[model samples]
Target: MHISEGVLAAPVLISGVAAAAAGCSVGLRKMDFDKTPRVAVMASTFFVASLIHVPIGPSSIHLILTGLVGIILGWASFPAILVALLLQSILFQFGGLTTLGVNCFAMAFPALLCYLIFSKLINGKNQSLAVIAGFLAGFCGVMLAVIIIAAALAISGEQFITVARLILIAHLPVMIIEGLIVTTIVVFLRRAKPELLKGVV
Candidate 1:
């Protein structure tokens, strides 16, 4: 879902940078110094997860795991995702440097939204509901990112609509896969490390 450099116009790129900067500012402020280790771990997870792509017809799919990070780190997912994307761009050129802001925002915004919407339910008392919330977080995270990506491409030209549609169709399997993965992880964390959910509001 990385928008390559030069694909997006200057206005879109600037807007992405400005919006991501604002989110990163708030995320940095909300991030507790003690949780730096957890953030780093998740950043690494994000970095690795996105690199393992599976070919499906003309398009490829990968596990974002952004929802997993978001629920754990809350707003801090912004900076974590930013760092991961930067490294990916610098080291592998997976995403070009000029498009870094748009790529990061595309991935991170849905993560923040998922955290805000699902964090409470995941932390709530009912296990069943919490599991459902986890699944939704993962499912919706990809869906929202898909929409954002489509919108970004749609802005570039009319022909991109078809490409965007294909991208969404290709990602359908990933949505289900990530939802199940996140649900399982949430259940495990609920049993073994409930404290991770305790402090995050």
Candidate 2:
């Protein structure tokens, strides 16, 4: 979910930019040259996925697939999300340039969290456990992002409390859909392309 540019206060926006900048720097440094194409592909996926949005409160909701990206790309999701968000802002104006940092952070932080929490299970030898982890990653990633968006809104106004709750409730379907999508992908990869899960941090 992309918060429109003018909704956030200056302090919140500044903090978002700083945090995103640091994460992007680390992601860039840790990036494998050989995986650049993979990064591009994920970035494109994120870019395209966010375009088909279902309107909600002040913004809209869509399938991020960010958990899948994080499990595969690790910390590199920061830069990947940043690039996608940048293009979305420029091409479609879905999210404004001024709000880019917060929007990117909103998506990328949950991705990092999913990576840390699920990487081991997804990379584990037990296929069942791996699939479960995949489901949780996809489910939790959206849940966390919803929480973050709500908190960001709550920071701006107490009136946003109801809006936040509504947004989370509205996204329930998306969470389940993403969970199944990620679980299936993980199962298939474990069977046909296990190498993709190797060396994930």
lDDT of each: 0.82, 0.82
Q: Write the per-residue lDDT of candidate 1 for residues 73-130, one digit (tens) a residue.
A: 7888888888988887779878877777777788889988888899889989999999
- Tell me each candidate's TM-score: 0.90, 0.89
Report the C-alpha displacement of residue 149, candidate 2, in angstroms: 0.8
Clashing pairs in 1: none
Alpha-carbon RMSD of each model: 2.3, 3.3
Which stretches of model 2 miss by more than 4 angstroms?
A: 49-61, 199-201
Q: Write the per-residue lDDT of candidate 2 for residues 85-143, one digit (tens) a residue.
A: 88877888788877888888988899998998898999898878998999999998888
